[model samples]
Target chain A: MTSHIDTCGLSCPQPVLLFLTALRKTEAKEFDVLVDNEVSRENVTRAAENHGCHVTAHQEGNDVTRLHIAKN
Target chain B: MKSLRNIFVSPAGIILTGAIIGLLAILLQHYGNPGNMGICVVCFNRDIAGGIGLHRASVVQYLRPEIMGMLLGAFVAALFFGDFRARGGSSPITRFLLGVIASIGALVFLGCPWRAILRLAGGDGNALFGFAGIFVGVGIGTLFFRQGFSLGRNTTQHRASGFVMPLIMLALVLLYLLYPPIAGQEKNGVLFYSLKGPGAAHAPFLLSIGIGLLVGFLAQRSRFCTMGAIRDVILFRHWHLALGLAAMLLAALVANVALGSFKPGFEGQPIAHTQSLWNFLGMVTAGLAFALAGGCPGRQIFMAGEGDNDAAVFILGLIVGAALSHNFDMASSPAGIAANGAVAAIGGLVICLLIGITNIRRGA
Candidate 1:
């Protein structure tokens, strides 16, 4: 199963915290994290990696980033 | 098997790190983190010291769980990714002294590097002086680096050294949780609270700590550092970190406008003084010490989480220095620079210069 976290309209650290919170509750092995800014992308990617996930793919849109993180 | 830094190992990674923090700082202010101060390392440290009874600065006392969160967040991230390593032994005393000098300098200016940038984005013109001072201070540190100024080598230590700081962070968190802010009062158990003034203003406790943890986790992985940004530019002509700082500044500016918090002026700024000279000198002193110490206060906390006991000692010095500043009336207020802040800034400059002069090698 995959989990999705939408962090649009939020600020830095918030997006990161939300991502971490999602990681804590999910039993899934994959996460799709969406953020609207550069900082959040960096943070989500980092947060995923910190929790033993690997950034498998990332997509960039006009103002949003969708990250695919999978457990190692 | 893994490390978090890999995710944010590129230029884009670092820039995003800065941008996110900048945006959040403004948003946090929009909610309630103080006017133009979202994540001031110096001020937060002072507040922590006040909360712990290090000094009796009546108005500014609270056990900011945000700071505690940063340490713990970094610790958790490092541990999860197997990057946590206990190390120390690089002129520990010298680093501590540098932290004290840096805190004093920041007190004179009433902001750290993060707050200085935020102040400008919020339309405080006086921050221009601070920016100037920061550059000049980094410039001096660069000269020393060119001369082979090194803080000695770090040696691996017992794992317990690393856990000590994390445990302290955990203990602080427990303290904050146990002693909720007293109803309509500033005293909560062993912890102190602020009923009024800038100290009284804050984001919700959970929000602040949650943000702090996120920042800590991300910063640890990205190796986000303000001092290193300028230092890299001066020494290597590298702009990766600089770009991050720029992005952060731009993001904050945009966020401030969106939130209707951008007020342009040199006077009547909240918790700020109009003494341009002091602002410049204050940053100069603080910046130099940060460079000499190899990181800013924010970076220090991150380093401390990674098992740098020396960095932890430096943080301790900062807390004590905050106490000393408040106790001695050396911190600035909206009214003006503190009574002896001028002399203290000058003294900090002297100390930093001496450290730079003596530590540098003729040839590496």
Candidate 2:
């Protein structure tokens, strides 16, 4: 099962930190992180990319963005 | 998907988000949200603390529904979206201590990050020092961040861990409902009600709740954060969230001009002091703590709603910190910074620097 991390209402480093924590905990090689706003979206994606994960993003409605990242 | 993400990520969308907050804050003030305050996280926390007898300051006690409403609004949103997680345990005690000292710093300055912005919007030039202090403080934190300062990693656990703070907010709302201001009475039904001062003036309860809910929802949706706004600008030349604050400034300025609340002067500003040194130092300390803590007070409250127990602990620490300041006269007054307040501010700086050094890793 994919670990879904919701980081809405959180800011840049926070979303990134939470996402990293989830990445560390989950055995699943695949992950999905939900965030709101561009800053968070960018920061989370950057962190995942730094971890050598491949990331694809999807935007929901007007505000939320979901990023799917998988280990190469 | 890239095109979709670009929509709200554009300059206009973030600006609109900031403008909405600014306009709403000014309007809330016009309708009664504390003079020149609009929405201040620290002050609201202090007021709530006093209402619950954390401090017996008779003139500044009121159980503000906006705080309660904000938490609940975020809680509802988190629940609906299936993001409610109760993960914590990342040096909770350390975070609690940071919140304590940060509250002391904010109390000395008489405002939090949002209040600093609100004060500037209302044309109080004293806020210039506050802004400067925050920049310096956060810059210091940024230095530590560059050097690998970290509080440690948060670990996930039980799902119920996240709901603690929201439950506390619910209890507070119940207390607010239980106590109706007795017109001339200060204490009513186990709650303290201020008859004068900033706490005495407020928008109607339901109205405040409605506005708080709207802000909570929008802020949650956009991840709007004051500290993050400035931090991003400092760390990266990114101006996305910065635009939100700029929009708030412009919109609040316009609203102040239209409402005749714009009094551009450094002297006799509402609930502010002319002691420039303390103002700068105060926010510097608070700002550093805020940066170390990784979010502003508003962000903490919203995080609590999402069931982050760490965030809730920070708020609890705020309550304890406020009480300590008031009980020991460690909080500054309009007259000037109290002796202990100065001591506390300096003490916080030393401790925060120490924390920064200790958390720095060799490779990190």
Candidate 3:
């Protein structure tokens, strides 16, 4: 199963912190995360990668970026 | 053009922004903007409060052009870069209270985080305690982050809402031009000007505003923030923001050395005090407030400029808090923290802790 989290309009550390919490609590090994800013995008990716998660990201529009994370 | 724009947000770009700000801040001082204080958001805000009759601190009253210029610069950058958005509605009152606490704490320590770094660069040992307090405060805030604490997310708003702060900045500039200060006069029309003291000692208006605008523009692009530097390191072990800090310190230190203004000691550092405990406690309050509010005062200003109404509210809180500090004797001086300063600092810490704990979302 894949868990989805929307962090659009949220600032740094919040998005990453949310990602980490979801990663820990959920039984799922994959996440589709939405972020609206560059800092949040970079941070959520870094946090996932640091936790040994494989990640792929793509810009969805002018402002929003979506990331796919899978636990290794 | 895209690649060049990308450089402004790159690691080297952030470092370059910091270096330029650090160097220019020193130049601001060399041109008469208080020693060891090139760019202090809290102090400048306090002075602006006084300038606008929000406070009556005679020695610290001026309509600082630097403050106005920064907002304008950021506004220009945001507009040009297509980063401007009219967004806000995340716990604005709470953010305002946080700004008040942040400003009071900074005033208690006699400097904001930027000034603390500049003080260190100018060889003031007193800043060591301030930095330590900030680390501890941010560390504590990080613990709350681990527990899923957030102030909620800002929502999009009407475009007019985004222009308010920049318009205010432009109005202030107009006020300055219309009511230019008169020598030996404290009041020029409705505006206040310092006849003497730190507020009176400023670099040329154009110079101060020019440096401020440049910094504001670059900081908007780089997202340079002092509190964010420490918070990023503590939360994710990320060193991206820390590089900006290191560059600022290094650049400022070298500039001070070349200018022969490097004076190392806990005592007699210009516009500073030697009260170690209060200094630590003051910044402890400030750092936590900044973390809770999600940016340092400088970043808050830039954010406000870029159409963040929440940030604008927070900036208003800072101005009001500055007024309260001076009026109620909660601000510090070169002699030491005022009688109520320590109490205010403790109160600020308690408020921050309350705000931090109460805002947490369990089972997020």
Best by DockQ: 3
Task: Estimate how well candidate 3 is docked, as a DockQ score.
Answer: 0.61
* Model 3 per-residue lDDT tens digits across residues B1-364: 4576679767899899999999999999999899898889999999999999999999999988898888889989988987788789989999999999999999999899999999999999999999999999889999988877888888888999999999999999899999988889999999998988789989998998999899999998888998999998988777878899999999999999999999988889999999999989999999999999999999999999889999999999999999999999999999999989989999999999999999998644
iRMSD (1 decimal) for each model: 16.1, 6.1, 1.7
Winner by TM-score between candidate 3 and candidate 1: 3
lDDT of 2 by residue, A1-72 (tens): 788887665434656656676687768888888876455677777668767899998877555788998976
Candidate 2 structure quality by residue, lDDT tens digits, B220-247? 5455677877886786545667788888
- The pairs that clash in candidate 2 are B86-B162, B162-B307
lDDT of 1: 0.82
Winner by TM-score between candidate 3 and candidate 2: 3
On residues B173-197, what C-alpha lDDT tens digit does candidate 1 reach at each position?
Answer: 8898899787698788888888888
Predicted structure with the largest lDDT when compared to the true one: 3
How do the candidates rank by DockQ, highest first?
3, 2, 1
DockQ-based CAPRI category assigned to the predicted complex of candidate 3? medium
- Estimate TM-scores for all models: 0.82, 0.85, 0.95
Candidate 1, residue A39: Cα displacement in angstroms equals 20
